[model samples]
Target chain A: MDEFELIRRYFAPLSGAHEDVVLGIGDDCALLAPPAGHELAVTSDTLIAGRHFPEESLPFDIGWKSLAVNLSDLAAMGARARWFTLALALPEADERWLAGFADGLKALADEAEVSLVGGDTTRGPLTITITALGVVPAGCALRRSGARVGDRVCVSGTLGDAALALERWRAGDRDRSDDALDLRARLDRPTPRLALGEALRGLAHAAIDLSDGLAADLSHLLRASGVGAHIYGARLPSSAAFDRLAPAAERTRLQLAGGDDYELCLCIPAARLSEVRRLAQQIGVALTDIGEIQAGSGLSVLGAQCEPLAFTELGYRHFQ
Target chain B: MDEFELIRRYFAPLSGAHEDVVLGIGDDCALLAPPAGHELAVTSDTLIAGRHFPEESLPFDIGWKSLAVNLSDLAAMGARARWFTLALALPEADERWLAGFADGLKALADEAEVSLVGGDTTRGPLTITITALGVVPAGCALRRSGARVGDRVCVSGTLGDAALALERWRAGDRDRSDDALDLRARLDRPTPRLALGEALRGLAHAAIDLSDGLAADLSHLLRASGVGAHIYGARLPSSAAFDRLAPAAERTRLQLAGGDDYELCLCIPAARLSEVRRLAQQIGVALTDIGEIQAGSGLSVLGAQCEPLAFTELGYRHFQ
Candidate 1:
């Protein structure tokens, strides 16, 4: 389908059903009239060619991941997906590639309940930028600065599976050596835990998505909250994907420094840890007690014996 | 300045001194209440290197034009400027370039009263994408589908100057000719005509921006409205820059087929013509009567004596 037809099919229905939305995908502008009790959360991210992903990655994955990453940012703030706009640049518009990309994008966007309100497509080296807007109760969104020294740092779902899967894919293992087909899919389609994030409202003092790996993402929370962290290395969730393929130290490195994991990393106070756990259970996602916020300026990793450990290459830097 | 400092300095107060904006630009997101009585208008556009603009173009100009184009989209729908988010991609984080770009962007944004709410920056070939959000009274947005046969098609401000300026820049005549300076600036920073758009809200039956040139953008409106247009060529607006350089025939070519002028093209009903003219004067932006919606399936251009004129390259093709 051409861009217009594709948009009409997938995006028109999203706005057609929502009372809060005043307009949708057909016109030059999508009109929004958010309900009175809600506040808007907005975030944007861009992924460029020969970076962010493998040089020859499927266009469909690129499309899905582009929107998914931005959605994760909204999730980190405990917001509900509402609308999104896309800016896509490619060498040229190929019908086959566009169809597949649209299909993949629509599948994910439909699942997230995000209306594709507007977008622009043009010619350039393939770059996809998605800006997503979400809604939250007024003055109730979670933020990084709300974390306290006594807060227990927690992560939703498993960590490092995406990174391990990427390692295998980069090495041309394709999830075979470690038999990590599921892990590889997790890496390819790292679902943003939006429901869990929304559920963590009033419980999480600080929240972040593990897009740039847990080590670096945690560092941002600590910096924002003016605290440090002591993460138990053994407490980090690891699957069989790591056991068969990577050495202990290397696995730890992957778990800490690897990127593209869209899981949520949150900080809950000691008094609210049980509530956070119960909420995770309600959402059917695993809640791992990864560490605790400390009154310092850096992060320390604890061994199985409970001794502190150090690391290098904290996480991926886009410029680096 | 670092990102945080830059954000605080440039974007912190975009929510306005008024309370309609429930959230401003400093947090992980910006929140909007939408002023209780208005419908929101949203549009996005992306400018990429070696494609949307010439490679020799200035970064500041790129910033201005990028935001202006999206603003023009809002103007087409007769929407009032409210807020916008910018996404910039550059090869590296150069403080000098950032300063200049932000300065230029803020200049136009402030003039339009379109607040700069939020955005993202990354490492890549320079790309500027902006999503402009504006407000229009409920049931009053001038859309493409509202045009009808016998409607007086009017255009605001001048046309063809930006397109001619682009040709001049492409031919490298921009620097040597002092006369081309204004033309170059037109190409670099076409105004969005927000005041005219706001004034035309009730008078316009249909409207669109002259970004892809008057011919293409109008074609989009006529197509959307399922009508045809009869535009008088002699009645079109031309700049002194065009008269001083290009021949009359070339100027006609520019007016007919060149893109990026960013003027507002609208269709007003025959009955509302006088009222529309009054509103245009009230806004102080010239509103020219250039065409009329006709009950046919194709656009026809009339010369000085009302005879038909022919042209090539009707407008830009997205894939090409």
Candidate 2:
């Protein structure tokens, strides 16, 4: 089938309707009305086959992960996702693959209540680029530069499971234990902390989504805020699966430096800690206070004995 | 350099500050505040190496064309360009290529008054995807499905030069005559008719950008509007360069079916014809009336003597 037919059949149906979407799909452009008093938050992520994902990965998973990563970025800003556009490059039009990809994308999109607006499909190596747009109250959007010296740095949900899962997968460990399966699920279908992000809008001073591991991503917040951080190694949250599979040191390393964890690392004012915890509970997500912002530069990790821990790797470097 | 550093060095500086962009590069997501009572128009385009452009085409040309095509989409929607994001996939980070690409992209973006918001850069086969966001007055944006039966079909600027140039290039014709060089420039840097589009916002009934040639793209407008078109073969605009380089029939074919012209195809009511011309003059762009929308469901082309003209190829097809 031709490109037009391929898009009409596989991608068009995925563009569900929304009131804010004045025009969706099948136009030179999609028209959207950003809600009054709200600002539009936009972020894009591109996932290339064999680079961003395994070549053998299911198309469905690839589609889900592609959009999920963009949503994580929006979630970092405490924005409510409203619309998205997907530009896809495929080596060839495979009907089954397209169907699976559309299904996977639509599922997450529906859950997020975000409409697929306009996009372009072209011929090339398999690559998916998704630009997600969200809305947040004017002046209330979370930013990385808002952290204060006394703010408590926190994270939502467990970390290191995805990295640990990738490690096991690369090592060809076929252990299908419940913990292993859970870790694999975390790696494949990461749930963006959208609700928790929205809840922390007024409570958190600064926030960033964890894509480049806790150490590196948190360092960005600190750098942007012109502050430092002291993360307690003993307080780092890890999935039960990660703890069970990895030795203590490896688990700590993954928690600190492994990537692809779509959790939120936030800095909440010390006075708002209880409120943040209450909101996290209300949103049904775990919130862990792993560290605190301090008056210096760079990040320091304190062990159980309160000694600074040295990490060999900071995070995943895309071009390294 | 790593992806983050590469983006900071090469792409970040291209993100000029704009009043509407509350947050731009380096944020988790760029926050935009569209003008009050204005709707956002969004479009995306992807250009792949070899498929979209010649493998040896200058990086600057590729970058310009990539964003230019997306701007053309916004122009078709009668939107004022505002913001854009670039997702680039490169085989490797070459400084010279990146510099050229950024320069090309920044030139057009600055001319269009659009700021670079946020995007992704990755390691992969060479590919560039640009998502552009524009703004239009509420209830005034042009759409593909608004054409009326009696509306006069019109186009901005000339057509066929790009296609003719591509044909000559493919045939190994490296003619350096003034006309040949002009055609080559047209093919490489076709200007997007943004000002004309804004001027036609309230005057045009329907609009579309000619990326897939006049016949195919106009047919999309016709199909979406549930109408037909009667285009005069002799009235179709062709640059002097195209006329000098192509034979009569081939020239007509290129004018009708050539892709990548990056011009605006619009449908204006018969009564508003003079207004459109006046607006076009004000915008300093040539406006050509080539046909009229009809009540039927297919397109028809009449030769100089009003006799029906038949053509084999309709336009470029990605699958083909």
Q: lDDT per prediction?
A: 0.78, 0.89
Which candidate number maximizes DockQ?
A: 2
Q: In candidate 1, how many Å is residue B235 off?
A: 1.0
**Model 2 root mean square deviation, Cα atoms:** 1.8
**Candidate 1 chain B, which ten residues in sequence have the lowest lDDT sum?**
B311-320
> C-alpha displacement of B51 in model 2, angstroms?
1.0
lDDT of 2 at B137: 96
The structural similarity of chain B in model 2 to the true chain B, as TM-score, is 0.96
lDDT by residue (tens digit), candidate 1, A1-320: 55566556544443436665666766778887765677778887888866677766676776688778889988998999888888887776676777667766777888898877888876777888888889888888888778888789888877778787777777787545435776766766778889998998888898888877888778877887889989998888876656665656577777877887788888998998887788789889898998899898778888889877646443445312
Model 1 lDDT at residue A123: 70
- Model 2 TM-score is 0.97
Recovered fraction of real interface contacts per model: 0.68, 0.93
Off by over 4 Å in 1: A1-22, A172-178, A312-320, B1-28, B175-178, B311-320
Cα error, candidate 2, residue A182 (Å): 0.4
Which residue pairs in candidate 1 have backbone atoms (N, alpha carbon, C) closer than 3 angstroms, thus clashing? none
Range of the 10 consecutive residues with the lowest summed lDDT in candidate 1 chain A: A311-320
lDDT of 2 by residue, A123-178 (tens): 88899999999999999999999999899999999999998988888888989889
